[model samples]
Target: MSSRSVIIDNTDAQVQYSPGWQANGSPNEYKRTTSNTETQGASFTLKFVGTSVAVYGTLDIVTLPNTTYVLDGGNPFPFSGQPQSQIQYQQVFYTSPSLPYGEHTLVGSCVDGGGRVILDYFVVEIPLEIPTNTSLSTPTSAVPTTLGSKPTPPTTAIVGGVLGGLLFLMTILVAYLWYRQFRDPGRRRDTKPSFTSAEQDAQTRPFNAPAMASSSYITTQHDAETPNHYSETPRHRDVISTVERHKSPHVSLQWNQSQQPPSYSM
Candidate 1:
């Protein structure tokens, strides 16, 4: 009997399987589960070559308790309008009915459409993987620090804050000194004092002397200049002196009223 090769398509299964033991790919074997938890269901594919003389054969599902046969012989599998020759391809789906938690076997036999067995024999087995106990050791060491770790304040900000504080203090001191100097009594000027009773009397005494001197001086000059003219004049010296004194407050004059006043007022 010639050995048949099986290709395990891991791309669809998404699992890693160890290489086959006896036949390179004959019923590829793999550990599905452990003794405690055995795998119940599994699926795989098998390929074979047949000649026109082959017709039918039986594929075996060997479990511990017993063996199950799906199809005893082949049927006329139609391709297009007629049966394919010996070089044709065929596939079959087979699953064991909940086998015992132990080793199992899948035996396949290929045949033509006329109940003729083409393949001599076929066999495949799936195994269970056993895991062992092991320990891992890690080293204690320092780790690299991140940029956000222990962030320090900027140097420029610190310098700017110190300068701002000094500037503010200087401005406050200057303002305080200016306010104290302006409000102090020692720095203010003094105003003149009010007059007393003695000072008032001295100022008024000169007022009376100025008035008397003006009156005598004017009368003596008038009489001496026009003694004869006074007797004939209608207007007397007293009228002229009174009119002159009334012109301004600064002029001091006094006139005797020995003669009668003017005709309009006397």
Candidate 2:
């Protein structure tokens, strides 16, 4: 960076004047040089960090005035009086030589003369802020060696992504299970449809049979052998009666003269 100069007003906290010195509001910049008993032995001090510093002031009473500047509490140097015309208002009263690039204290004091001093401001000169380059051929700490390793990402990000993926998968699994549970009962309740009587008559069997012919033959034989005049009441025959009829195939008839033909009416 470049060097620069800054103007610090007398009202800045860094400027410390002895007690009983005049302090008008901060807007104006004059530390009064003379009060009733403050004309002589009056001192103002300021600390700053820079290459050099210069104190500027206005001369209200420079007639036979005596002042001195002390830097870093070192030997004092007297303020040189200006020739011909008395300097006033924002004039450099004393300036320190180019000093070190660190903090230094500058003190201005009115020694003997009763002349008044008005400290307007102080200027501090800062030197260039360039940094020097340093060589580092060796590492201070050991580093690990891997043949082919990918750069590691942040732990928080990787963890978050994994957790998010797992959560999404869990949500899908729950939804799938819930859907199966909702659908399975309806599937189990499914039943085959019932057929009507008319539909059953329209159906066909796989095997062939002569059921109609057999039933018709049996019916014809029973009708021809039966007489209508015979008692039509239903009868139950005993087993003995069937066996006796099977035993007698013929019956011998003994006819006597007394046995006339029985009269029959048809």
What does the lDDT come to for candidate 1?
0.33
TM-score, every prediction: 0.20, 0.42
lDDT of every model, 2 decimals: 0.33, 0.57
Q: Poorest 10 consecutive residues of model 2 by lDDT?
A: 134-143
Backbone Cα, N, C clashes tallied per candidate:
11, 0
Q: Could you give candidate 1's per-residue lDDT for residues 1-266 as a string of tens digits?
A: 22222222222232222222111112211111111101222222232111101111122222111112232233323211124443221222232333222323233322222232212112222112211231221111211222122212236767999999999999999999899888875556656665676698778775442433465466667767887765533355556557667754566765555634445434
Where in model 2 is the C-alpha error above 4 Å?
24-38, 61-64, 83-87, 130-266
User: Model 1, stretches more than 4 Å misplaced?
Assistant: 1-151, 179-208, 211-266
TM-score of model 2 vs. true structure: 0.42
Alpha-carbon shift of residue 113 in model 2 (angstroms): 4.9
